[model samples]
Target: MLGLFIAQVLNGLLDGTYYLLIALGLSLIFSLGGIINLAHGAFFAIGAYLALLITPYVGYFGALVAVPLIVAGLGMVTERTLFTRFYRIDPLYSLLLTFGIAMVIEQGLRWVFGASPQSYNIPDILRGQVFLGDFIYSRYRIFLIAVAAVAVAGLWLLLNRTSFGRIVRAGVQSPEIVGALGISLRPYLSIVAGIGIGLAGLAGVLLSPIYTIHPAMGAEIITLAFVVVVIGGLGSFWGVIIAAVLVGLTKGVLVAIGLSSWSTAAIFLLMFVVLLLRPRGLLGERILRFE
Candidate 1:
């Protein structure tokens, strides 16, 4: 029983990685663009569908590499065509826009692929279990953790270490100052959107094998992803990471205690506690635009 409890805790942590991937992108896009992208999950679904379509020709590894880039390109296009128009306007406009896009993508997928769920097999190379003492875990999940960690670390370095990141951070604080410095945030905005949305695509690819792939899969996950972002605070990168872990831990503990049916409710309860304590989120920093 103790072993099972420990295993459930670990499983919960693994579950957090999925939210981490999706929520990071949600946070980044909102931080930089001021766009509350409701359609981000649709992109995630697209990635999974794209993986299914391409994996046959390029294989799983190939799909993993190619799908994100393709989705990122699509994100860049969306930023240029749709997001750019609403940057200086009311945020609600962008929200509505993204919601419509989400619906379109969902229905488009349904039209093309039907409403049925699709299945993806685990790659042959990653198929197995690893036993650690009395606990056993999926090898693919281990690989998923490693990939998510690397992606997070790389993103951190890019934001904290690079000149591009410096500008983005400054822009987040004060777009007026960035504009005064004669830096057109246009290119940066496009790139950020691509990077953020691309991460969603990557999550879709990595999770497709384990999750049921369907048109509404994106919709199903987006709410939890939003919960993570809200609990973490809107623009705080580290907050999102911590929140994801906490959310996962909360769910894990609930399951371990034999309240598995209440796991989802427990996460919301955890968020309520966090918000009651810290309205701005655990580490949410004040930004000019949001204020």
Candidate 2:
């Protein structure tokens, strides 16, 4: 039982890593850009598909490098043509617009790729297991955990150490004050949207070897991602990290207890309980949005 619990904890923590990536990006968009982007899942799905499509031609590493750039470009275009229009409108308007975009991307993928679950072969380099005392662990899974850790740490440095990150952090607090200093927000807004959606795309690409890729894959994860984002609070990246691990732990423990069906319900319950008690989330500031 102890071994099983330890294994479940490992699984849960790794699962939380990807959830962290998705929620981190979502929090940035919500807090700074003020876009409740339902289309985030689409970008994630696209990243996966693009990786699959490119793998045959470019190999896995190439796909990882190339697909994110392509996804970032797509995100930038999305911001310019669609998200920009909703900037001055009510926040709900942007959410609805992104939701429409999500639906359209889903259908488009279905039309182009069909509704099949596409498989990705794991590279031979990461396919084995490491035996530790009485337990064995998959190398690929450990690699994923390490990668997720590096991703989060890198993003933290990006947002907290660099000038670009500093501006973004300040903008999250209040864009108005930043804009008053003569920095035109239009370009920065596009960059931020690109990064948010790009991170989703990156998440998708990394998930290619871990899960079957399909049109409905994004739909499956988005709800969970939203729960983590809300649980972690809207504006705080650290909150996203904590919330993601919590959700992952909940699902893992519930599955171990033989109630696999309750995974989604578990998240809903956790979010509800957290909100009921904390109201502003673990680290989320109360009423960050002035409107």
Candidate 3:
């Protein structure tokens, strides 16, 4: 029983990786561009479908590399064509636009792939279990955790240690000042959108083996991703990380305690309590545009 409990806790912590991937992108796009991208999940779904298509020829490893780039390119295009118009305006407009975008992508996927759920087998190389003492875990999940960690760490370094990141951070706080300095944020916006949407794509690819691949999969996961972002505080990078862990921990504990049915509800309860205590989120910063 004790080993089971420990295994569940570890599993829960690793599960946070998925939320971290999706929420980071969601937070980044909203923080910099002020666009609440409802279609973000659609990109995730697209990634999974793309993987299904490309993996046959290029193999899983190849699809893993190519899918995110493809989705990111699509994201850049969407930002240039659609998202650019809605910046600096009422967020409602962008929200509605993204919602429409989401619907269109979902339907387009349905039209192309049909409404059926698809399956992608785990690559044979990663198909196995890792036993640590009495606790056993999926090898693929361990790999997933490692990939997520690297992605998150790399993103942190990019945002904190690079010139591009500095400009983005500044723009998020004061677009007017960034513009005053003659720094055109247009290219940055497109790139950020790509990076953000691309993260979602990567998540899609990683999870495709384990998750049920269907048109509604993106829609199903987006809400939980939003919860992570909200709990972590909008625009707070570290906050999102912590919140994902907490959310996963909460669910894991519930399951471990034989109250699995309440796991989902407990996550909401955790969010409600956090909001009651800190309205701006765990680490949300004061952005002039949001203020």
Per-candidate alpha-carbon RMSD to the true structure: 0.9, 1.5, 0.8
Model 2 TM-score (2 dp): 0.95
Task: List per-prediction Cα lDDT, in the order shown.
Answer: 0.93, 0.85, 0.94
lDDT of 2 by residue, 1-291 (tens): 888888887677667887777787788777777888899988999999999999999998788778878898899999999988887789989988988999999999999999888889778898999988656788987876777787789888988899988888788777788899987778878888888888888888888898889997888889889989988888887899999999888888888878999987988999999999987788886545643
Candidate number with the higher lDDT (2 or 3): 3
Candidate numbers sorted by lDDT from highest down: 3, 1, 2
Residue 108 displacement (Å), model 3: 0.6
User: On a 0 to 100 scale, what is the lDDT of residue 225 in model 1?
Assistant: 98
- lDDT of each residue in 162-280, candidate 3, tens digit only: 99999999989988899999999999999999999999999999999999899988999999999999999999999999999999999998999999999999999989998999988
Name the 10 consecutive residues with the lowest summed lDDT in model 3. Answer: 282-291
Q: lDDT: which is higher, 1 or 3? A: 3
Ranking by TM-score: 3, 1, 2
lDDT of 1 by residue, 1-291 (tens): 888888888888778998898999999999998999999999999999999999999999999999999999999999999999999899999999999999999999999999999989999999999999888889998998898899999999999999999999998888888999899999999999999999999999999998999999999999999999999999899999999988998898898998889999988988899889998888988876697
Off by over 4 Å in 3: none
Count of backbone clashes, every candidate in sequence: 0, 0, 0
